[model samples]
Target chain A: MYTRILVSALFAGACAGLIAGILQLYFVQPVLLHAELYETGALSHFGAVPISAHPELPGFDLMRDGLSLIFTMLIYTGYGLILLALMSLAEDRGAVISGRSGILWGIAGFVAFHLAPGFSLPPEVPGVAAADVTVRQIWWFATVGCAAAAMWLIAFGANWMVWGLAAILLLAPHVIGAPEPEVFAGPVPTEIAALFAARAFGVGLAAWVLLGCFAGYFWQREGVYADATQSA
Target chain B: MTTMTNTRSGLRILPALFALALGGAVIALTGHVQAAALHDAAHDVRHATGFPCH
Candidate 1:
């Protein structure tokens, strides 16, 4: 069972990571590079006037691109392992682990890891300033944990009471509020920053949706689908 | 039957251990193991994807 999960996670993580890495270079990286210009003062937000023309990667920046690919794969593999572990636990409790089910799990994973944390802390451009790292980190993890539990309750609970509990769990961290910086400072203009934020969120949504589709497909393909056999 | 039950218990033990080890590696990489340039490379993606690297 462990071997099946390990291999399946590797397969799903590799494919999804590859796609995500590619997508980032195209969609996310340019915005980042643009932001960096403002960060470094190489270009002003309105300096060139034509926002459509983004800079290209330097001709020999292989090391940078290579590292991006490797990191993307590693991070996605970590996500896949967690996803598979959850499925295994669910199956032990007699829940069916199928592609369809994987889709749901994948969405939950996205919400837990991405959307939940993002609600309080949106993605930032390079030069934007904000809260202390430690406080933000603490709040982020708390949000993910609460959101994950809430999502599970909402998905599997048998009654309205459980749903009510889920709602509270979902909102508890937000109610406490995310830590804020004393002041906001950055070189990037608001318009460019807004564009970056939108693109970043859109890219995240796509990657997470693909993660669900791929995770579900790969997990189910490993014979976890339609099997009454519990391997413990 | 006793042998089958024992094997099943052993199987259960291993995946939990496997999951633990995997989880540990993840924590280490994202936490303590984050060095300078690597963290810088990862930082952008982490922040962009809403992971807490701020």
Candidate 2:
């Protein structure tokens, strides 16, 4: 059972990663490269102070992009494993993951991973000012954890009290609030940042939606059928 | 194929092992080396999560 879950996750994740990587290369990378030029003084935004040029790393663009693709693939594949494991567990309890309702699973994956966190922190473009990384990382993890739990409860929680609690947890992160930059000063233009943010969000949404559908489809293929008797 | 795990445990374990190793290597590489693009991607996720992982 675990082996089936693993293979399914690897294949599905790789597919999502390949699709997302291509999408990012086209829709997202150009925007990032554009912003980097500003960051590196190869270009400037609104005549911002002439920033010092940092030494370029070896392998340059090619290495970075390759690594980006590899990293993206790895991350999604790992996520796939987790999602499949969850589905199997859910199946054990009689939830059927099939072609028909898989897209709903995909949407849930999107909401839990991308939308929930996105609501708190929209994607940032290159050279944009932001708060300390550690604090933000902690908060972001907390939010993903809370939001994921809340979403699960919303989906499968049996009681109204569970739903009420889910609502509170969902709101908890926002109420506590994400940490903000002390001063929002960066060289990137607002228009460019806005475009980048929107595109990035779109990219994630598309990828995660794909993740969900793939996970659900592959899971069913692995033989997790609904047992009518158990479901009752 | 499904029964392989029951009879030939090794084959069943191969895929999981391979994935684990590949996943581990990638994580190790990303952890030690800070490539800007990777950093940017992580930053986007972190920032999207409203977290600053740098």
**Candidate 2 C-alpha lDDT tens digits along A157-228:** 999999999999888988988878999778876766787778877877788778878888877776543343
List the global CA lDDT of all models.
0.72, 0.67
Candidate 1 chain A lDDT trough over 10 residues, lowest sum: A52-61
- Which pairs clash in the backbone of model 1? none
TM-score of the second chain for every model = 0.60, 0.47
lDDT per residue as tens, model 2, B1-54: 768534555543454455545644553344223467657545433322222445
lDDT of 1 by residue, A1-232 (tens): 7776787778777777788777777777777777787788776655557554455434324677667777777777777777777676666556777767777777787787777777778777778877887788778778877998898898789999999999998888888999877887777778666777777677666666666667667767776542645654
Candidate with the greatest TM-score versus the true structure? 1
Clashing pairs in 2: A133-B52, A136-B51, A136-B52, A137-B51, A137-B52
Please state the interface RMSD for every predicted structure, separated by commas.
Answer: 2.7, 5.7
Q: Tell me how far the alpha carbon of residue A1 in candidate 1 is from the true structure, in angstroms, after superposition.
A: 1.7
Residue B53 miss distance in model 2 (angstroms): 5.2
